[model samples]
Target: MSRRGQRLTHLELLERLVSFDTESSKPNLALMDVVCDYLEGWDVPFVRVPNAAGDKAAVFATIGPMVDGGIVLSGHTDVVPVAGQAWTTDPFALRIADGRAYGRGAVDMKGFCALALAAVPDALAADLRRPIHILLSYDEETTCLGVADTIARFGADLPRPGAVIVGEPTGMEVADAHKSIVTYHTTVHGHEAHSAKPMLGANAVMAAADLVSELNRIADAMIARGDASGRFDPPATTVHVGTIAGGTARNILPKVCTFHWEFRGLPDLDMGEIPALFAAKVAAVTRERLNRYGEFGRIETVEEVAVPGLAPEPGSEAERLALRLAGRNHTISVPYATEAGRFQEAGIPTVVCGPGSIDQAHQPDEYITLAALDSGAGFMRRLIGECGAP
Candidate 1:
C-alpha cells in the first residue's frame, strides 16, 4: 500500500480500537477480536493465549518466514479507566482535530497497537528472510498480569524472540531502564466492642495507621540514603499507601481494616528487605496486642504485584535495534514499569521504544499527535525492511 493508503488504514484502525472500552478491570476478549480479525484479513498467522477464566486473551502473530531471529513488537490491549476523568470528547470514541486523536488509551497504548497492526500488510508484502511478530496482551494497566502469562508461554508453546520491543509511550526514544514495582494488600483484624469500653476491644484502624506510618518512615530512610545510581527522579525506592478503608461506625470499635501499598525499587535494591521489615513490624504489633486482646488483634499481608523493571544494558541487541528503528543514538530510563523487564528476565533482549508521550497517558483528554502516529508507522516500515521475507 502507498503511504497515503497506510495513513488512512492506520487512522481507521485506531478509531476502531478506541471504540472498545477494554479497561484493565474488564475482560479484553472483545478488543482481541478486533486484532484477530485484522490479522486474519491480512493472512497473518496468530495465536490467542486465553486466561484460565476465558474472559481475557493475549495475541501472538507472525508475518514472513518462521525464522529463528524474529523481532517482537509487544503492546498491551487493556487500558486505564476513565470513569471519573473529565473529557471533552467521548473516552471510547476517537476524535480527530488539530492534528491529534483524542481518546483514552490512544496515547497510553492502542496507538502503538494500531500502528503495528496497520503495518502487517506492508510486512507481508516485503521480501524478508526473518519474521516480524506482534504480541498483544491484556491487563497491563493493572499489574501486567496478562503479559506475564504470555511470557510464560514463550519458548514452550510460542516462539522465543531474539529481540523484543515493548511499545510503551516513549516518544519514539530507546528506553533501557525502569524501576521495579512491588505491591502489598494488608488487612488488620481486631475485636469489636462498644465505644464506651474501648479498652476491651482492639483498634484495627489504629494499628493500620501505625503500619502506614512505619512504611512512610522506611520510605524516607531509603530516600535519604539515596541509591548509588540516581537515575530515577526520586533517586530511591519509594513506598506509598494507595488506599485505605476500615471503620464501620464511630461508636463501635472496627473489626477489620485494609489498605494497599506499593514500592517502586531500583534494580539493585533488595526487594525482600522492605517486605521483611513490614512483616516484622506486623509481628511486633501482634505480639504486643496478644497480651491484652489474646489473638483479637493481628495482621495479614498479601503480595499483590511484583513487576520486575527493565535494566539498561549498554550496546545490547534490543537497544541497538530500537535505536536504528528510532534513528537515535542515546538511551534513557523511565520511572514507570513495563513488560520489557519481564522479557529481559526471560533472556530476550528487550527495549521500550514507541511513539506518543507518557505525559498524555492516564490523564483526562488524552491524545496522540498525528506526527507521533506517523513516526510509529515509519518505525514499523523500517522494522519490516529489516525483516524482509525470503
Candidate 2:
C-alpha cells in the first residue's frame, strides 16, 4: 500500500531507484528486476521486451480496463555515466540536504519514474473510465537504442494508447516542441609514412581537419538559415564533433582518423541536407587523394542514430489533457530530444512534462528540489482523477 499522505514514499522510491547504477554502458537488468517486482506486488500485468543480447529490457504495463482511448506514461530507466564527473556526494546513493535530493538520475529522470511508480496505488483506487499505461524503457541515455525496438511491439504485443506522456525533465510544464538529433561516426583512411617524407604518404589528420572545417562552415550557414519562429536559442541548426581519435606517434603520418559528431535541427527541418553535403565533401577527398601509391586513401561517414524532434501541435488532445493535469493553460518548447517524438510519429498524440530542471542533468552533484517533486506529485494525483478530467 502506498501512503500518499506520508510524502516520503516517492522520495524513498527515488532513493531505491538511484541506488542501482543503470548507466547506459552497464546492464539494466537489476533495475528491471526492481520494476518487475513492484508491478508484481501491485498485481498489474505487464509486457517485457528484451534486447537481442538480453542484457537490457523495457517494461510496459496497463492499469484499469483493457480498452482503447487510454493514456500512456513513458520514462527511461537508464542514466549517463558518472565516471569522471566530480561530485561531493555518492552518485549511486541518494543524499538529501537543503531540501534537495542528490544523485545521478535524480532529475533526468528517475524522479519522474519514482513518482509514476508510487502513484500506481492511487490510480488503482480511482474509478477510472479509461486505462493508464506505463512505459519503462532502457538505454535512453545512449541513442535511445532500447526503446526503438520496444516501441515496434506497440499495438501488437501491447495496447496502443491514444496519447503518451514522456516523463523527461520539464520542470512540470507541458512541452510540445523540441529539436531533432542526428549522430554520425566518420573515419578517414590514408597511407602512412615517415613525417620527413611529405609526398610519399597521404595524411589522414590533415584530411580530418579539412572535414571539420567544412562542418564549421556548414554550421555557420545553418545559423544564417535561422529559425523563423524565434523559439529556439541561436535559432539555427548546430553541428559539433564530440570525440576524435587517431595517430600512432608524432613522427609518423596518421593512416587513420575517427570522430563521432552530431547535428541538432529544429522541428520540421529536413535533416538530410547536412549529411548529404558532408558526403559530397568526403567523395571529393577520396577522388582527389586516391592514386597509384594512395589506393586506400578514403573516407567514410556512418549514421549512428537519428532522433526526431517533437513538433508543436496546437489544440492537440495531448496538449489539452496535459495542460489540465499540470494546471496550465498553454504549452512550451524545449531544445532537448525525447522519446515523445517517436510516439508522435507513430500517430499517438504526445507531450513531455515531468520534474526537475535540464540544467541539473549530467552535471556534478545533480539534485531535484523537494519542491519540484511536490509539483510532480500534484500532477500525478490529478492524473489519477481522470474520471472527471477534461
Candidate 3:
C-alpha cells in the first residue's frame, strides 16, 4: 500500500500515462497493467474484463467491499489518433506550458483518469460508508466496445453502482444529458465493365451517391422537426457522411464503393428509426436496379456502435448527488456522446461532470489547465468525504 502520508501527483501520473501509446487502433493492455499495478499498490481489488481477442481489456476496481450500491468513476483509456493533426510538439509526450498539460488525451480524458488514480490514496485514507468504483475502458475512441463487457458483468458477479460519473471533459459543469452517436459503414457492390460501355455495368458510386443524398434529406427533415429541450445547439438529430471511397481508374467501372456515415440524435429522438429508414430507402432503390442487371448488386449497412442518449430522470438520486458534488444548481446538455449513456443503459443512473473543455479535445496541441485539474481533485476529495472508505 502507498504510505499514508504519500500521494501520487497528478502531473506525475499524467506524464507516465501519456508515455504509453493507447491510440484507438493499438492495444491498451500495457497501460491497463500499469493502472492495475497502481491500484494493487493501494490495496484495492479489481477485475479485468478482456476483449474477445484477449489483447485489450477494461479494468474495474473497487476500493470498498461488495455492496448493493457504489459510485463508479468511469473514463476511456484510448486516445484519438494524431496521424493527421498538426502539432507543435510531440503529441504523445506531455508538454507543460503556462500551467497547462498538452498531450493527445489531455482534454478528451486520461487527465480525468489520472486524477481518479491520484485520488485513490486520499480515498483509501477516508472512513467511507460506500465503495468507490473505478472503471477504465478501452476502444472508446473507435466504438464504445470496451464498456460493453463491463456492463454485462454487472449484477452477476460485479456490484451494481448506484450512480456513475463519466469523467468526460465538461469543464466541471454538470452534464445531465448528451446526444447519442450511431455510426454505420455502408458498402455498395456493383458490376465492372468498360467505361465506354456504361450501360453494361451498374454504377456502385452512383448508388452510394443516391444514399448520401437521402441522408442529407433526412438531416433536413430533422432540422424542420426542431428540438423540444432547447438546450442542444442544433436542437434536433443530425446526419452526416464522413468518408466515401469508390472506383480505381477512369477507364474502368468500379465494382465496389463504401461510405461511412453517422447520426447524432437528441435525447428524445428515436435512434434506431433513422438507420432503419435509410436502409429501407437504399433497399428499394438497389432492388430496382438489380432486376435490370439480373444479378444482386448489394448495399449493406453495419452499425459500429449505438450509444443511447440519456433522458433526464427528474429528482433522481444520481442527478441530485452529481449536482450537489459539483456545487451546481443546474444541469446542461451537450452535442457529443460519452460513456454515460452506456452506463445508463445498464440501469446505472449516470451524469457527465469532469475537468477541461470539449473545445480542446481532439485538436492539435490539446491541453488541460492546472486549474481544471485542481478543481477536479477537490471534487474527488469531497466525494471521498461523502462516501467514506470501504
Superposed by TM-score, candidate 1 places the C-alpha of residue 44 at a distance from the truth, in angstroms, of 1.0
Tell me the tens digit of each residue's lDDT in model 1 across 1-390.
223223337788889888999998888888888678777776778999998889999999988776666899999988898989999979999999999999988988999999998888788779667888999988787777787777787777777778999999899999999989999899999889987887788878888888999999999988997868767888888999999999899998888999999999887778798998998989887777632656678788999888887877888888998999899989988889998878888888999999999999999999999999999999999998888743
Which tens-of-lDDT digit does each residue in 255-296 have in candidate 3? 889999999999888767897789888887697763356574
The number of clashing residue pairs in model 1 is 6
Candidate 2 Cα outliers beyond 4 Å, as residue runs: 1-8, 194-199, 248-252, 290-294, 387-390
What lDDT score is found at residue 334 in candidate 3?
78
Worst 10 residues of 2 by lDDT: 1-10
Native-to-model Cα distance after best TM-score fit, residue 121 in candidate 2, in Å: 0.9
Q: Per-residue error at 14 for model 1, in Å?
A: 0.7
Model 1 ranges off by over 4 Å: 1-8, 194-199, 248-252
What lDDT would candidate 3 get against the real structure? 0.86
Q: Global lDDT of each model?
A: 0.86, 0.85, 0.86
Q: Whole-model lDDT for model 1 versus the true structure?
A: 0.86
Cα-based lDDT at residue 198, candidate 1: 74
